[model samples]
Target: MTTPVLFIHGLCLHASSWDPWIQLFRDAGYDPHAPGWPGDGATVEASRQHPDAIGDHGIDDVVEHFAGVIDRLPSPPILIGHSFGGMIAQKLLGQDRALAAIAIDAAQIKGVLPVPLSALRATLPVFRNPANLHRAVSLTAEQFRFAFANTVSEQESDELHERWTIPAPGKPLFEAATANFDPHSPAKVATDNQTRGPLLLIASGKDHTVPESVTRATLKQYRHSEAVTDLVTFPDRAHSLTIDSGWREVADTCLTWLKQQSL
Candidate 1:
């Protein structure tokens, strides 16, 4: 039987953002599934029209929600996640819930320090609005372009914004940002769990949200782990590496890596 794969999207985007990736992995003979955030609208248009559907959710809610999906699978999945979803993949791996994992341009967990200026700028929309902590936040085309599609063409960026962008709960962002000080935070991940399966951290060179530097720092945090941990850097890609016109290239790269692992 083919091993199941779960594709998790980052904030402000729905599961459909992984449509191309799902098709690519399916063709590669993996049973791929992409589940949306809790209460997410069924489509981008619906999400944009009704932001409250995804409002007020925090990291724990999302982690538990995805865990339920994982539990229903026939076997522990090969987890693949982007942005905040990437962080959840790491958390699940720590819990011994995945066979192997791939995190692409993933958000940082508790121990990752040295927040980059670009990353901070990208969060300004949510951070600047204190009320956003309890509400969903939507990105304008300009903000989306600056954060995820800066390296793509303007036309493509606009199209991406129109097709995939939606409101995201700001609670997760707040939780992640203040994790270091929150003893009960859900943003923490056990990087040293020897039981954790192999993990591949993919970094986009031009990503303003999760920079290569941030990825390198995240990789360093797991140096003491006995499990196999790897980092792959795409020097020309941005945060939207998984969805841009060059998405097939990223998908092929991940497929090739997984094949090498015999996954």
Candidate 2:
């Protein structure tokens, strides 16, 4: 049987972020399912009107939401996620939920331990507003430049800032910031489990959010599964590699990985 694919979007964005990848996967002969977070809207525009959405969504909430989508599917679906979605994917893997996975510029993997200035700056505005705890704060143009468009052109950066950047839950960022505080952080990505199946971690060398060192450190956490834990870095990419210019390359890489592991 063909293994279905679960394409989970990152924090703030909805399932619509998978539109391009979804169509690409279809051509590759795999089923793709993308799910929205609990308070997410059906469309990006609709989501904007409700600025309070995603503010309180925690890692557990995102995990359960993705698991719910996987449960309704025929069987365990190959999970692919980005950013916060990537953290949720690792959480799902700990439960032994799926057979294979691919994470693109995923944030906060088990061994990843770096907080770049850019990431901190992009997140500062969220923490600045205490009300952001109960309401999502859409990314401003400057914030987008720091977090998602660091590697793109000025025009492209502005376009991305307008099109895709939206209010996101501050809870995930807050939790990620605190991961180093407690030894038993619930938000820590679980990569030590060897039975988690084939997995790939794709990092954007240019990504300020998930730095190369962070993703590399994450590999050590899965040292036992050296063969299954694959890592790739897009030298010219940023945090928004999936949507950045030349995204087709990233999409193609993901499709190829899925084919090798699933098909």
Top-TM-score structure, candidate number: 1
Best by lDDT: 1
What root-mean-square deviation over C-alphas does model 2 reach? 1.8
Give TM per candidate. Answer: 0.98, 0.93
Write candidate 2's Cα lDDT for 96-203 as tens digits. 898787877777753466767766676788778766666687777877788788888888988876777667888777777778786776687666676677888888
| lDDT, candidate 2, at 144 | 76
Write the residue-wise lDDT of candidate 1 on 200-252 in tens digits: 99999999999999999999989889899999999999998888899988888
User: Which residue runs of candidate 2 sit more than 4 Å off their true CA positions?
Assistant: 225-227
Question: What does candidate 1 score in Cα RMSD to the true structure?
Answer: 0.8
